[model samples]
Target: MLKKSLLLFSAACASASAESVSVYFGNGCFFDQQHTMVTRFEKLLLKRSGSDVTSVSAYAGGDSSSSDLCYHNEGEVEDYGKLGHAEVVELFIPDDKSLKDAAKVFFEDFTQLAPGQWTRQDVFDLGPEYRALVGIPGGVSGPYYSAIVEANSEVHNLNLKEGQGGDDDTIDTGVVWVMDSLKFPAYQAEVCLQFSDDNPAFSEPYSEKYHSLRDALFEEGTLRNTTCPTNYIC
Candidate 1:
């Protein structure tokens, strides 16, 4: 099990000039075989949120240690039957965006893959649309996600495994967007998806990465709600 570290914080503050933000992705069966999946997630997050976003896995919803960060992988038995799972990511936006707007950017970009068969190439193709929101703006770049070497490396390694399919193989998946700011201590909101027969993606630990990916896609199209269930700790 990975030990808990101090919850990551962004250097930018949610003041008049800059903002600190965090988005928690929930209800996908992230498994041991999917280490690459998680790694890719972090890379995309860092690219979209900025070069400094911090991402971590956690047992959110209703695990005994839900408040504490939990290791996300096949080896963690406690995560097997839990209500759901979560990935906490912190982002720093300077001057131009609000945490709320950043959250919307994430929702919009991710939802593109919610339905139909989309590839990472599709994500890359949306670079222009995401440039103002996530990119360096006006800066000449070879690739959209070329800000960090680690992210580039992970993207490169994604091809190391052959024959694995896209996100169509997983089960139900969804995400709840909650933002807390030091500037506004009382501010909090929950944005989650409503589950249905066709789109049943809520966060959970998976035995394999493929299962998790499908569910993760399911979550993108679901509706957002203000409330989290008793079983869920959002």
Candidate 2:
């Protein structure tokens, strides 16, 4: 199936008309134990959506397996930089679909992890200043701000599913969904969001800070209402 998927992706890439969007996984590494999780999510988006969405992974670290990786610096560097090692997953969305809606679907599904996984996590709707700092473009007027949600377990442990490792190994980790714009017309327009944190999830005011932000985003429509598709996978 993996080979088949790649072939299909290649064909899609060859086509002249294909829309694209980039999703930055802050503190996210493709080689981590949970790498498959994001890949599966990517496939799901394409399968369920009306558009032909193909994705590619870009890493900000050495190719060596033992190299340092994680979201060490997010939004602080010129190149898709993060505080820790991270991966930028680019999604090519078909022209027929709204990139906004496609992104909404990805976020909605991500937050739907197993009950235990989400129960302790706090979600945040980033403020305008931070939103603009990342990639989400817009003023305080529209529902354009991005969301930063808490991860239920330690960065390393969270990668594995329920039974893969000790299920109880949970920690405070932050992830966000961002939207950006593309400069040239090759793929036309582009929007990207980075899910990043500085290992401050367990920190004093930061934890409380994000929870409060989550509440505000919901109220302001930054994190608008999204219902899961009847047969969708979380």
Candidate 3:
């Protein structure tokens, strides 16, 4: 549905230095009807990662006519299930941080990082759109990439399968998939779904503008309006 790159790499790269990088991941169960639960998790991601990161519920890691896709609130069908896209979170990591900061949160945040609470067979099934995966754009090699590969492998107690890919790469951790983001791209999700319960101040200027744009894009109550803010910002 969306036809854009995961991150505006060309423009972002041009403007910011290497210290400030945007890394994206399909972190499972991007959507939640429970407003309090969503905000609590958002705060956790911001706090534990130890970064003032901006995030969104996004779609990625499946074939499409184009790389970009959108999340539709499906009652019978799961979000983006028809398109085979995975529910993901696109995080904007601020200056002086590396991919590992994001990686730490991805691997350590929850007991099980896979998407959705119930499996597909359950009547309450949230579907398979929730898959745990990490993406790094540009095929860029350095300490940051190595850190991701290393942490991912360590979490799974895996050894590097050399000649397969990166020296420390794991194709599938039996639970997580690690790959270059360009392979299966990500883009912004629906606008009303942008920041959800978190305040725009937490996510920089984009959140404020996204709320307005979300209003323009969807009709009232079409998408759940962001609930009351629990905290000002993390």
Candidate 4:
């Protein structure tokens, strides 16, 4: 009887170990701009991990109102789309190996956006500030195509203003670079990630690298930290 009970307990543990990991991607207002990037990122993650990543989903309603840093009492509730500051992308992994593999891919792919890749001189001019905003370590030269790299960097000392008492005078410094030229209007892209579980195995290095990218992007002025009262947009 004891042998049979032990077998049942071990089976239950094994089943639990095989539980699925769900990944979710949320995009606030800039859904269209973020779609292609997210798609590319997702494909890369799947390819690198060689794990069973089940599906990818998008939500269009905008970030949750309660978390907005610029929240106002009289603001029109219908403007949810305009008020949202960030978008999200999520993935689910079936096991630990899959999760770790996906994370490794994420780090590798993101690091490739360094300043050395810009091909145009005009865009290259703005690379430093872009790097500063996104917290990239060095500078690059060439064209604006590298702006994506800048936008993928970081923002530092994010301070939120609430009511009249909070620090309002501080115009939180971030990297900003102009991309518009003789032919085109200036544009920028920002990317960020949020994980559901606090798995220590996944959080540490991922967070560090993410912060580096955030600094680089913010330094370049392509990404801004709009996380309000809460440190997260969603």
Candidate 5:
């Protein structure tokens, strides 16, 4: 049902209105994986999409934050997993760059196997948080959805959903589920995770230190509430 080609993207771009569009995307863990795509897309798409692109790591597609808190292990009540929150990257796209571009970079590129490997082994965990998702401001329908999808059709040949993004736990068959981002609000992850490693690249060819402090934090646990090794500061 989905086409795989990027050629249509040019036409969609031409017919698309001049107004800007902001979108959110969640494909996998936003740690160093999909997180890297944000920076890459920003460098290339910032001119039209705006300079405020962000890789907002979040807990989404679940019950309710009011029902449970985030950043903690699975619990009987205060668990993100039980809340149905998926590990997601809430992208702030100010322009309609087409979901294809976002999906391509987030799913296809910046992988552990290799760039364009399509191995579906991009993330370290499997859960709702790692599900592939694309969200428009209103919802995933109407002219805006068609416009972005049409724009995305440009790369239908590339098979954005091929191998189902290498995961079977999708809302749809190998396709990134499109929804109204407003409806499925994202609970922003811990602030410390967003703490930059002061490195530009997070992939293989990129810097090798993207996970330094963040990794340290992961080991410590909680929001900046960790005790570091004697050699390091928490």
Candidate 6:
């Protein structure tokens, strides 16, 4: 009986291993409120994915001030450096069906919360940078949600390097989400990832994606309810 029980346990472990899928999330530098928002988002994702999911990870980091600089002769130099702040979120799905189910749930949940102007395809295409910049009041403009969708669509098919630009043909399946809230003097942010590891070289430059997303989100008045941190000073 003991031997039989041990065999059963081993089989269960193997079954679990066969069904798991990995996911990652990255949140570029942000304050406390932003962090709370990201946590909530992760919880929601877990709920949608269900029990078959195995693991979850998140990466969070960002800078207080805009790193843009001016050069007399050269084009305007935008530094856009990160504060080396980041968090990671990861989730493991049990099988292909579970992965698809989780994605569907993510899309539905995201669409429900975001304004009617955006769709799942749009959000997926936006990537992390685009998502962070979304709803910012006075920020730059770019294809925010669209880029995310595009990246996600191809994430499963590519072999991503830590920091390389030539893989554009493959889906750039990495992202960093940023959020900020001034209330309670709280400065917090969280990062989530669909990938396995943290490659600063690749992720550092990805901060621009958050910058763009933040700009767009602010422009839409989505962030008006939140206050900027006095310490960060924009």
Best by TM-score: 5
lDDT of prediction 4: 0.26
The sequence of per-residue lDDT tens digits that candidate 4 reaches over residues 1-234 is: 111111112322332335643322221222221232233444454442112222221211122223222322244332322433222233344454544443333323221123433221112222111111110111123232243342233211121111111111111122222111111111112133222222233223333432343344334432344433322233
Error of 1 at 2 (Å): 22
Question: What are the runs in model 4 whose C-alpha is more than 4 Å off?
Answer: 1-18, 25-53, 59-85, 111-234
lDDT of each: 0.26, 0.26, 0.43, 0.26, 0.45, 0.27
Highest-lDDT candidate: 5
lDDT (C-alpha) at residue 142 in model 1: 18
lDDT pick, better of 3 and 4: 3
- RMSD per candidate (Å) reads 16.7, 18.5, 10.6, 19.3, 10.8, 18.2
Report how far residue 65 has shifted in candidate 2, in Å. Answer: 23
Q: Each candidate's TM vs. the true structure?
A: 0.29, 0.30, 0.52, 0.26, 0.58, 0.27
Positional deviation of residue 91's Cα in model 2 after best superposition, in angstroms: 1.7
lDDT tens digits, residues 67-165, model 5? 223554323334556566666655444444445466556544322333323333444556665666655555554345654465445433123332212
What C-alpha lDDT, on a 0 to 100 scale, does residue 87 get in candidate 5?
Answer: 62
Give the lDDT of residue 17 in candidate 1. Answer: 35
**Model 4: per-residue Cα lDDT at residue 35:** 31
Of the two candidates 2 and 5, the one with more favorable TM-score, higher being better, is 5
| Candidates sorted on TM-score, descending | 5, 3, 2, 1, 6, 4
TM-score of 5: 0.58
lDDT of 4 at 29: 23
After superposing candidate 6 on the true structure, give the runs of residues whose Cα lies further than 4 Å from its correct spot.
1-15, 25-53, 60-88, 111-116, 119-234
Over 4 Å off, model 2: 1-27, 31-42, 48-53, 60-85, 95-234
> Between prediction 1 and prediction 6, which has the larger lDDT?
6
Estimate, for each residue in 24-102, the C-alpha lDDT of model 3 and write its tens digit: 6653455431121223433454342112224545666565534335445333223345666665676545432345545
- Could you tell which candidate, 1 or 4, scores higher by TM-score? 1
